[model samples]
Target: MSIPHEIENYIKLQPESKRNDMLELHERILQNLPSCKLWFLDGKNEQGKLVSNPNIGYGSYLMKYADGTTKEFYRIGISANTTGISVYIMGIDDKNHLPQMYGKRIGKATVTGYCIKFKALKDINRDVLEQAIKDGAKPRF
Candidate 1:
């Protein structure tokens, strides 16, 4: 039905460990983003083929394409993956920003340019992750 309902359903479908972790992360990201937009992508392409893990998104941004088209998208996203959970910080100009800034300090996680992935919340520096989300949440207008 609604985006929030869909997000709750997606999180509930995860395994016990992942379910708990996703719930915590969902709340944390909301707290950081405040009254931002919400999104639920059901991991399917237009043909309904599975293209990725279902993800919950927060906030909003304009994604500019090379051909001069712009699309509104989420500023931050989270999803449950096969091995762990992935957090996406979108609309970054540089691909090395996240890794270079928080790779070593953010605990046992893989800090890519636009994503920070970890097996569980306990495996990362909660404060560091929150800071990253906060930084990413700023409207890239």
Candidate 2:
């Protein structure tokens, strides 16, 4: 019903190992972005078909589209995937920025345009990951 309740329920539904990691990431995000707006998406498209994994979102920013329209979306997000977890750092204009800046330093994580996906918390450099999150959380407009 509530954003936090939904997030906690989602994380609790994860496997033990993943649950702990997800909880930790959730706390970390809250600590880093203390006043952020929280969100929970049940991974369905408008048609209610399962499209993506459930996402726990943080912060807020205005996103502008090429069509000269804008919408508010989360600045950072975390989700449990089939293999591991995905940390989404939305609003980066340069697709290459993340991979170039954090690909090598964030350990085994895959640094895409707006996501850092890893198998486990211990597999990556947490500090670099935090910095990346902070970088992405900066004002988007």
Query: Which predicted model would earn the best TM-score?
Result: 1
lDDT for model 1: 0.91
Q: Model 1 segments beyond 4 Å from truth?
A: none
Model 1: residue 73 alpha-carbon error in angstroms: 0.8
Best candidate, lDDT-wise?
2
Clashes of each: 0, 0
Instruction: Please report how far candidate 2 places residue 95 from its true position, in Å.
Output: 1.2
What's the CA error at residue 25 for candidate 1, in Å?
0.6
Candidate 1 C-alpha lDDT tens digits along 26-108 = 99887777789999999999999999988899998999999999999899999899899999999989888889888899999
Candidate RMSDs in order: 0.9, 1.0
**Residue 120 in candidate 2 has what lDDT?**
94
